[model samples]
Target: MKCLKSLFPTLMICLIVFGCTNEDIDENTVNESSNKNYNSPNYPIKSTTELIVEYQSGFPERKKEDLRKKYNVKRYEKCDCTNSRIEKWEFDPRVDLEGRNELITQEGGIEGTDYQFFYDNENSTPGVSGSTAAGQSDLLISSYIKASNSGVTIAILDTGINLTRLPQSYPFLYGTNSDMTLCEEGEETEVSGWDFVNHDNDVYDDNGHGTVVTSIIIDKLFDEDISDYQILPVKAFNDLGKTTTFTLLCSYLYAVDKPSVSVINMSFGWYGPSGSLFPKFILENPDILHITSSGNDGINNDDNVHYPSSYTSNNILGIGSFSIKKRKEIVEPLPFDSRAMGISLLSPREIIKSTFSNFGVTSVDFLSVGDQVSFYDNNGNHYLVSGTSYAAPLVTAKAAMYYQNGHITPTAITEQLRLNGTLLAYYSLPIYYGDRIIE
Candidate 1:
């Protein structure tokens, strides 16, 4: 079966070559740019931050009106910052005063200069925590009760997954439309995937970030105790972790059509106000679930929540990270890590053991030990890596499990997370961790 699957790609290529003719090729050229629209609005206006503030403040609410009056806020139709408006008096003394003062002095918020604010204090070292290990077992046990991920398709809307790098234990998992029978030594499966970044189907990951995130959700399909799930790979980011709103919009559009895909996992984020391509998708398909990483910027927990996490809709699950050690010890909170809040869940993020950990890089810097390394291959080896990136998958995997068991709809899963998650009081604010408990 495996050998036959390997030959499938070769056979398909040969068929395509023989099936084509000069006229067919010319005809294809005419249809090639059919989807291109030069007049379409450029995605993710570079000045979205200012636009977001305006949109939010412009809402007809009594509170907003009061704030505007008190601050003497003036909405500049166009300001520096990409020809977008800036509200002159919309600042909050409680939240923005200190940061604003620093900005005026040009003394703080400088990317690398503000070490305490910019650095990821959580999981500064990476390795497997007891929570991840236990979570794996919990996934298996949950499978017996419901097979939570079975038949549920999750579209990983991030970087692409390298099917070749997956362990033999999970070889059945193929790329979009790719042949799954021949796990090794075969042409890459013909799995259908779109790259919003390059505007093509070559959604391969130059950086291993997407691969790691995908593994967290899809690992159940390979685990001996639980191998009954499906994952759809959707690439939206490039190697540098940068992606535009257009790419994300394209990815969401694609997932909306995939009947089996009920949930989408997004681990990347930026600073912007709510309302973007994601909300449009939710408004159209109220049943689908959208999960995003609460950003890593070390602001007050609630202050760092990034969109689509901040979108505050029924269909979105905003995820945060908590350090879980052996026997469920909660380590000191990391700086800049988003605090778990309404519709958010906190899971183990510190020092997670995965295939492509950052062991070598951190070890070279004397920040982590090599023994903490989990897996290694031609792809760069990794040690304990920590970020909201890892935390998003933990919640996504649990949601997949829940979906497989028929315990919740994709939208209901978001609500369940909030219901079951732990609530914490920090910095005089209450934050919620949707369903994932430390026990």
Candidate 2:
């Protein structure tokens, strides 16, 4: 189950561990809908009003202040996620955004700014509405499904969770003391999770994506009568499914700080490189298992990189999608003449790659049934949605089951998957170690 190490020679070297600090953040309550206006980037290069800057280790505090003053940084705050290694700089309104981009590019960046980057979530189907109640799929069933005595926690980072719609029968959410309106704040020294999109403790799922994703994990656990696991809900994306790199990093720090959390289910991704310190954060926290979606772009990740999923961290496992129901159309017997037409044929293969799911022998480790999976909205109505987003939680649920069974480390759980997997080919293209249908 060890990943293909040759693909990432650079990451093989140990990374520098950033300095740590306890920085207090001033809570600013903002409307989730207000996030709709932030610059949405399909690629990280797209400009945004917000920028993240990481100062070199042992950099003088006075020099940092001088750089901010020169750039007219309207507001600056240290990221608690990096233990104060990076500062988020918001430019003054008087400075034109284009001018800011020009200055950063032309000057090679401010004196101490070692890295500058932006990040946001990209939905496969952004505004498309799902169909009304289609019956749930039976594709995700696994022998591993069963009740757990140990209370393993999985922090879901996406649009928040809607507790009001969660069924009372499934008492899986962390910190829910039989009160539906409790917001599920963390117990003991833990704060359930944070809502970085809105800058509040209320992690409510107004957009329904998080609710659907959570329901998938719950479904796997509930059907087998498992109820002891805790779900730490971290709202990183807003109602419109947009978020900043600062918020994404903040969510990771929050999840890692909690002692109970062992698994993090990230069902979203974007293409291109991000200059943020996310890879370093994942590298530093090696014990926690990070399950990321390989994305739904239908492109090969080896050619075009995807963040976190393609970061080559041994602890990170990328999950892609395959479908038994979706099929491909093929044309046989090529015609040579101009007036001739080839016979059209439909391939009956059941293990083809989900049309929209991204794949790479190096990046994606496994594939699950992702097409036409059933999920619920904020109002508790059922719908069939298809994406790598839905596919990831199946593996997350399986990982939790393994955790309960004493297969705690990422290496052990990955071995379990390798032993249980069924190798297959997608239209003659062999997938090395995936396409495991949990029957």
Candidate 3:
């Protein structure tokens, strides 16, 4: 997601908890968190100060030995889980703030109509949280539930959620066990997540970035009965809102390894080649849909490549942001809203582009509102946020719903999503928005 530049003013006194959160903030500032643990010696807890070599699989064992002998390596292993042969030899990687979620949020408030779109009726009234992204797409689920997409899971690789803030009424979170100490591959109990920063099982958010982001994934709907849509939160960032490549790699590897997870929402990104390891896994695991923000950087991704976003893999869908403006227009016989609200609009809905959304004809796939969107914090306080960060998850939620309609695999979901997408005609865009999905 694009980094938020400022805060929306006018603090409303309600935590509206229906439909995906609505955001209309400046600089596209969406909240994101930061911590836990690797128990095995081969996969020792990753530290920014610690370094390793990212290599392809099948390099000679002797060559690795020579490198180890030359560098006097502290530890080395060819990781099999995340991706191909990675010669993880010890060195100083100089892990900095590069891995942190670029999402931005300032201390402030805002004034806007909190329009919460309900299950079938319009939740015109906003709650303690804020508005949702659900209505924006004209994409609301059925008044009932089905098992078409049952057993689907979404892995959120970010800071982590606030544990104490679990919902009492219903469950939007997954994993019963919180003990991350016995984090062995394919362990006995179902694992929620691990934090590479603090090297523990506590994936809870220390800074609230992860919590807000996770909320954006499932908490923005008025119909709170979205069962079987599970959230697996992984804390990849630290309290400083920063992380290392190694830490991110672990999170990605862990997420893909899970069979239940068909969709992965990555609202964070870096500027250059994130190595071939991630893309390699994505291709091999074509069943999983890996989606990421085109980046919050306000430059053309074509000219300035943003890794993951700039990747050429078919499984990866690079997303941009657009503040879906509701404009009044006059048709041949009647007047209409450009981006219609309330009941679902027809195919190829009116197109409006967000000035801050990053785009590339070759890289970007879709655009959602990346402006000031509203959501709940760890304390359930309602506030608006913006950025590509929020937009990615809004798309994720929609994709999960699509899977329920029988489009399951990455290939199927991607095509079906584009099939029903809202095509943007306002400008020459990289992403192809269709009429099938949104209407």
Which scores better on lDDT, 2 or 3?
A: 2
Report, for every candidate in turn, its global Cα lDDT versus the true structure: 0.42, 0.62, 0.52
The clash numbers for all candidates, in the given order, read 27, 2, 63
Question: Which lDDT tens digits does candidate 1 get at residues 209-319?
Answer: 666666655553344244556666676766555564444554666666665677777776544334333565566676777776654443332443345565656666655
- Candidate 3 least-lDDT 10 residues: 114-123
RMSD of each: 22.5, 14.3, 15.6
TM for candidate 3 is 0.64
> Taking the tens digit of each residue's C-alpha lDDT, what string does model 3 give over 1-439?
1211111112111211223223334432332210011111011122443344544346566665765565455666443233434444453355231231111011011111011111110001112222221111101111111223236788888766564443323445554333332354333222355655555555656655565566666654324345567777777775545665555666787777665788888776655444545555567777877778765545577666766766777677777777554434323321335355222333223344445556665667777755666764455555666566667787787777777778887667877766567543322223322222221
* Best-fitting candidate, scored by TM-score: 2
Error of 3 at 324 (Å): 3.5
Candidate 3 lDDT (Cα, 0 to 1): 0.52
Rank the candidate models, highest TM-score first: 2, 3, 1
Give the Cα RMSD of candidate 1.
22.5
TM-score of each: 0.50, 0.69, 0.64
Residue clash pairs of candidate 2: 141-438, 186-192
Off by over 4 Å in 3: 1-51, 54-67, 74-87, 91-150, 165-169, 176-191, 220-225, 326-351, 378-380, 427-439
The per-residue C-alpha lDDT of model 1 at residue 83 equals 16
